[model samples]
Target: MQYAIPAPPPWWSRLLARMSPTEDMPTRGRHPRALVTPHHDEPRPTLAELYRARRLDMVRLALFLVDDLHTAEDVVQDAFAAVCRHHGTSLDGLQDPAAYLHTAVVNAARSVLRRRRTARGHTPPHAGYGPPVDEGLLLAEEHRQVLDALAQLTRRQREVLVLRYWSELTEAQIAKTLGLSRGTVKSTASRALDALEKKLKVVR
Candidate 1:
């Protein structure tokens, strides 16, 4: 008797955590019963390949938010493993899996922040230092200045900016992902932009 095991709702499971959803539908491979096998099934090759494909990008993004490559890698790897554990099969159902993954990465980064806080009571990194880049060409002076401005913002402002402008997520999506009220998200984003604008004007 091969009965299927139903997983929890995708939203509540925290499988992808805070990473943005994927741009394309992730393939979980074909199972005799369904396109995606249930949670208990061994991880399919498609999911593994999918993780491999996205791992590097996720690491860079995580590094931008968390400021440590090693920790970022762990976050990215955890996200992949989670997708395999909880949503591996259902990832194919997602419209924008890349965005989903983005949310997950962001969440995992937050968890990392919480853990770090508990351990060392350190504050999050400043975003106003420069636009985030992953192993790219050296940033120009202006670029460094931009990041410096971003770093000066509160963590809320920086997160809203990254999710809204950098990730292109909607206010509704950002609010839901961050477990905040939609109005709060909008206000935070507005304030963040306002602060950033003031700094940019001064820089110019």
Candidate 2:
């Protein structure tokens, strides 16, 4: 004997039957459609926004590195401008814009220091020489001594120390920022601290 097949339910009925009450329910006061996959082309932050968000901190980092507020501002400005020149408003192009900017500031500060050194080397001792005044009047005694000691450090040593202590970057972070190996960072930091202690005459 042949068996008769049952007819399928109406399309509307089938659709309604397949719908679960929970599946259509809103979650945490949000519509189900609102949970959308983000698009890859979503606009990234502009350079202006990045500069606004990070300029002050960048300037401070430069200040500690270069030890001059005006030079620090110039360094930070040049860094941001360089980013803009290279990437325009598309910060997404950079793997890490903040890191890039940090490196740029460090490089720029090094250039400034190099130029200052060259200028000092060429100047005659008597040309525009002024009588020495008590540094304590200009800076607190402790501050003057600390600055004097810092000035005595090699550029790289000073940079490593400032980034390590003032900026409080980890050895790995400092290494990446300065394009040095972790071993180099550790050795440089140790030697720098030792030299600083000697300059300050701080007893262990």
Best by lDDT: 2
**What are the root-mean-square deviations of the candidates from the true structure over C-alphas?**
12.8, 23.5
Clashes of each: 39, 0
What lDDT does each candidate get? Answer: 0.59, 0.63
Candidate 1 has what TM-score?
Answer: 0.55
Candidates' TM-scores? 0.55, 0.67
Off by over 4 Å in 1: 1-46, 89-96, 122-145, 198-204
Model 2: per-residue Cα lDDT over 1-204, one tens digit each:
222211222421332233223433322233221112113554455677677656766665676566665777889998888888888886767756656777788988888888877887999877732313542233344544555677688877788776766455677878898989877777777777667668877521
Q: lDDT tens digits, residues 81-200, model 1?
A: 666666665465544455566777887888886887675545355522232365223233444455567657876777776666544467777887677777788778767767876886
Residues forming the 10-long window of minimal summed lDDT in candidate 2: 29-38
Backbone clashes in model 2, listed as residue pairs: none
For model 1, state the Cα shift of residue 68 in Å: 3.7
